[model samples]
Target: MTDTYADLLACEDLLLFASAAISSTGQREFHSGAAEQRLSLEFLHEYVHGTHPDLYALALALHVNDHNAAAIVHRLLSNPRTGASAGERARENALIRRRLAEMPPQRVYRLFARLARERVNNRRTRATMRAWIAARPNLDLDAVKYRPGLRAAARHARVALPEEVGVFLFSPPGERRRHRYGSPLLRAHGRAHYSASDLYDLPYTVAEGFAARHRVPRGVFLEGVRERATRAERLRLAGTARRHGVGAGPDPAAAPLLRLCVYVLSLPTAERRDRRAELEGALAASALRAAGPAAGTWPRTAAVLDDSYSSIGSPVRRHHPLAAALACHHLIRALAPDSTSHWVSGHTDPLTVRPAGPTHLAERILDALDTGPARVVVVSDGHDSTPPLLADTLTLWRRYVDPDRATAMVHLNPVFDADGLGMRPLSPAVPTIGLRDPRTLPSLVELARFGEGRLGLSDLREHLRATADAYLEAP
Candidate 1:
């Protein structure tokens, strides 16, 4: 019984840390400032790593955001391995490799730069850094785009670079101007200083700097760089591109589901209404793609979505919580097809749903429960107000009305509640999971079972091991 109780505590701790890891990026939320968020996150990372180092490492294989993943890698690599078997260390190393590969190039470069700054040049760290940098498809492009970071990483890792690439990165400005580079991108970078035409051949981010240096007109530079911009870049610069009289940017349908939702919410209500057909069609298609095989799988689903004022999030992450809710709203509908969404403010239109009124989650929960959905998914920051009866309602519903536990329910919180040290739970009766992206909703719901106290620590470990194995095995 003592061992069981200990396992239960460990499970709870893991869940709590996972929630913070997935949702919090050490940025300010609606209620918490950046400092508080960072401090809380740091404490949780240390506590979890001390308590369960293996589970802490396994989180990299899960849906942890890039920020926390970098932190996890740093923490794991900074410390020497002890007590773990050879197989365990190998699994941890594999997890790190996969995660570093999965992170965006700029972020990984930044992580490498950070490791260099911290002087974390252990054998494992050096090998990991060297391997990742050596794996880059185009070191010339990296040198041009992320010169300082690439140089720092190479120096710290002691990894040798191609001669021209090394000169492009390490040579002084005068020396680079005197020398010629074989790589077109590297040559373009050197020429971009004096030649406006050469800037277009470089990546948009690198070209932007050269364009500014050359005093090129914004319109002309934008036109020239349009072809060089990535899909995500085009979407991000759509408004700017339009203001400068570029074409109607990229198609909305090309956006990933979560990014598209954020973009849709960023637009004014009138614009969203005007482009309702195009936007809705794109959202439906993206959500369907994100749902994949799970699309239209669950029947009679209901979602109690929070569009309360708190969903406005902080200035650093404007409408982030609401964006998560909006994305999940469409995803749940796609997943169940017949899923009903009940907004806390009683708003019906998902497109025009904005964060305004106080959170009234209890009433929405009651409305959703009345519909007898096979699954009740609540997407909120978990800040229920106007009497705060969400806990009681869920508790009583589970105890009296749903004693058989036929209806499944899970709370997905997009914002981390620093005060709670995890996602603020609607109730202990319902399992709450931190959600960063709507695409991971299905798997996250499945993962929430351990938090329900029914699954032991061994079961949780098995799940983590399986997840890590699959993650490593995937191409």
Candidate 2:
């Protein structure tokens, strides 16, 4: 089969598989393409119902190489009967959009071209093409090779191309030749966006040249180069950045500068110590208030901040779960005067606690909740290394210290659970939320209320959707 046809078939098969998986109430098998075996619809149903987030991620990755699969993903996302929550579906949609944006617009246009011929009546395919076109208005509209298919798709979709593109498309071969901007090959390469991943395979000088040509911002430049730079090279880069006013501007709102400093500290300890004052200054400036709680209309919150090795082991520095946990602690303490903080490490004082030792979570967590705080929040990776079983401990806490279970207890996990599929609840009693973006903490609390029977997934989804919509609409 031709490449376009194969891609179309793959997309169709994936959509069928997903639809079958979702529609299965208890059936064991569904014939999908050549695959003729039981794939455990029960597990898949459970997975989509909120057992794991990874399954959806896996589904995305399965046919990611095929641009047509994006249409399938869009369809899967819109299917209301699927077990995935509205928030999960929205997150998947966002992921697909980002992935689409990262691709060369030509490829997306070509996919549209192929879909136009193969699935002429597909409204989703046409809508998807229009979305990509709208996102990249800077792209040359007439750059695509397969003119007839794309023109048909655009016409059917009622998509109005720019005047120049429309003129080029309709004009005869000689006219098109005259108006052609440049070698399509060269233009395609020029339009390919380079990201931090580009640094891994390319030479440093080449990457630097690409960044300079693109006028990539200082923070992005640092992220692109940090892992590959030598200690001395990093210092030199920092000095140059300071001189050029690259990263020397006033702090932006909700800046994660503290986490960035911790990433800097992750370099050889001796090399990092020279900038100790700078790190300290960032921490101080970012804080809304000094240590200790402030008066406010806040609940008596209790938090067990996990400083275990896992939190510090995040692949992305900006997402250092430990730093995020510390930031959360500071924010809660500053906002809620009656709050108590528990640092889960080998220290009594919260400030002195460091991320060491395999998490001895069950005991420390139970002890924190036993204090009778109005609400309990556990920021962890949900790994109880030394445990009289976390679930058992939670049972004990509920039985004695919290018979009424009045406290809104939540497990905020920043790490993706590859094993459990989604963020795993520490116990059946506590709700676990995937804390991928800490800014979503406000809406995520509703999940805890859902677990407590005070709310539902619909409520959590509404709150999350509002938050996402507001962010999108923000000036």
Candidate 3:
């Protein structure tokens, strides 16, 4: 990781700047590897106004003594993603015109942003997040609620209400996943498939999606849902069933409750954080009535890909000898274009895996629902081909839940310490709880009954104190 001063100066400055620009704005780069290989295409003179001001400064500091500018540029150019945008290219041309004037290249606002992100990484934000993920398996979606709630999920009107209402089930790895929403809403409306692809990719990170309630069901999606007679039918019926409202169905207490299962799957660490923020922002807006914090009780949400860590790319995981066909199917789909990605020029299509769609994500949600008997509502970004798979997964898991009561909600939530301060799941095979009714976020936290410790990220400071004490005892 050591570099000579002259080594840094000679690298391609334009390419470096472009990489930094993209990083600052948080945009995905469609064109990769073009900058590193193609150097001679833009036959411009060596410009001191290098692409990255910080990189230039570092190089300057290193090679300033040697006065060896060319050598430094050569080293920096070795790292890629340095192409300049049209405007930057024009600015470069102008700077070259006055090469004799030799003004230090002006700093772009973009560079500052990239540098800030760099500083944060250096400070260990990533390390903290990783530790959080690996700390422990905190919930089992199966045992979240008891029976009597399974018949009418996401509804409380049934007179035979269970002591604890089941909202959703969480299914982890190595288990059959299903969902009530498994059936494709699109199929009843038009000619859409009933099931979607499974989660083939392993270690897929998931989270409750961000977007305030009411504000959620985005305009684009709402329009689509409105077109669906079943969705409209359900909404209209729910309205009539409201307590004060007429024809609000049979329940006078069932508020205007619409449970949306929002799941952000396999997003990069940074994007995951961003999505969480978005969800928090939307929830905090109070645009929609809030529910309890749904402790780790999300519907069956697990990603099952062939175990191929240390692979070159996500696609390469398929090149192995011990992989399942369906696993490959799911992996390829996850590796393929995101729901909204556009094709590149002259590139018809990758002919690779296609998306499983919203139905698939929802099916997983529904499958998780079986782990317990509860009324649940699932919401997601609704992209990808998730809708179809959802319909099928539910019944499949139902059969698996219990052959006798085969369709009954399965006990997925294997709560290890139901009465402990920090309860976590212990089902090695599968354990996780689905999230239903997001307004229940507040209830998710089970504070220490004796007030010893709290359960959640916000309790990190307390965790740190305990860790520090343990370290002292060990020493």
Candidate 4:
């Protein structure tokens, strides 16, 4: 092939891989099984790394899910030769550190454990693992909560631990029970196996096993742990807490937008209705927080949201697609107060939207376009019940109705099409970007310009480089 054709092909391939990274978390989707998802994702990662190693490294800065982020870190760390130059290697190392810091503690520990399992015990791996473990704000909490993972990582990386922590982790069970510990957290953990009261002092996740072993009453355990639970832990345990008659669950207002949307959808319809005021207020506030300075800026924007049955997602994800659409619904409302929303099922209330209808995307597209907005954002999995009709509709609208292209459209798909190894686009006329987190909505929309074929491969490389630099420089 000619040089231009090769560059175009490379650009398309990179975009496809990027979309997969953003949407696929190696989990089952509505139409694809978990194994298929994993296989496709692995293949894409390999292809992208082989073809465009620099862009693959830069993808760490994008809104990739935890699974892909871990995978990227593993690939880069395991294969030092992947970086062709000293500067490239430094950038990759910096990106790895940033991504690792952004991930949850459990995930970072798990990544370290995986590295140990794979026997990837290179000098760089050892240093990175040791540094991360040493930098943790509370190693005592990690020892209690993630004992096995922390122990394995420390051993693999040969990370020296605090004197008390070393004994707490490596001591035999008999010795641990007999020896007195300096750290209160460690002392509680050692006593938790025999003492129920001590379990309350430990993190809730670690305390639960001991609580069960002691056969502590669920209600009592919950009440005891309520004061100690973190915000995220409280949100997760709220339903159980309510069932057990613990204080009214954590306030919804403090939750992040995407998480709040998922939490709301996890509740039964009756509870959601009963808590309508609280939930709606939380959603609105979270959306404003997510939008930040960009809130209420796009007065002429419209959204075509999909609430079809396929959006029910898989058991693993549980209403993930619908949740994304719901989050986008709130975000769009916040970003453009006057924007029109056209749901596929014609559902007017965002709070009670359930996935239970055919994907009539063509009609919704038509409705959105009729609003005469400057931009139209379509959030869907692109599984239209009537094949080709949505594409045909957009084609006709773009060709005859809006020949001047006054209205711009982009599709943000949350479901990964495993068979296709990328997002299932509704129409070639519109750019389809993968949607993972609602907070990244504005940036992803701006990124749609690259997917529209308006920019060349050089522009994409430049964009990735600039994005990497900005991310590394950010606090």
The top-ranked prediction according to TM-score is 1
Which regions of candidate 1 deviate over 4 angstroms? 1-3
Please provide TM-scores, in order, for all candidate models, with all chains considered together.
Answer: 0.98, 0.54, 0.16, 0.97
Q: Estimate candidate 1's alpha-carbon lDDT, on a 0 to 1 scale.
A: 0.89
Alpha-carbon error at 251 in model 2, in Å? 6.0
Question: Model-by-model lDDT, in order?
Answer: 0.89, 0.52, 0.25, 0.88
For model 2, the superposed segments whose C-alpha errors exceed 4 Å read 1-121, 135-297, 314-319, 347-354, 370-372, 453-475
Stronger candidate by lDDT (2 vs 4): 4
Indicate the worst ten consecutive residues by lDDT in candidate 1.
1-10
Candidate 3 lDDT tens digits, 1-475: 2334333332323222221221111111111133321232122212433334323323221112111222233223222225546654333322222221221211111221232334433212222223322231321211121111222211211222222222222223122123332223211211111211111110111100111212333332223333222332434444322323433222212222211111112223354455565533332232133322332333322222111121111231211111111122222223221211111111222222222211233334444343443322222211224324544454454356543532212111111111221112211111122122223222211111111111232242233334323423432
lDDT, candidate 2, residue 180?
Answer: 42
Q: lDDT of candidate 3 vs native?
A: 0.25
Report backbone clashes per prediction.
0, 4, 103, 0
CA deviation > 4 Å runs, candidate 3: 1-359, 369-458, 464-475
lDDT of 4 at 130: 84
Instruction: Give lDDT: candidate 1, residue 358.
Output: 89
Error of 3 at 208 (Å): 44
TM-score of 1: 0.98
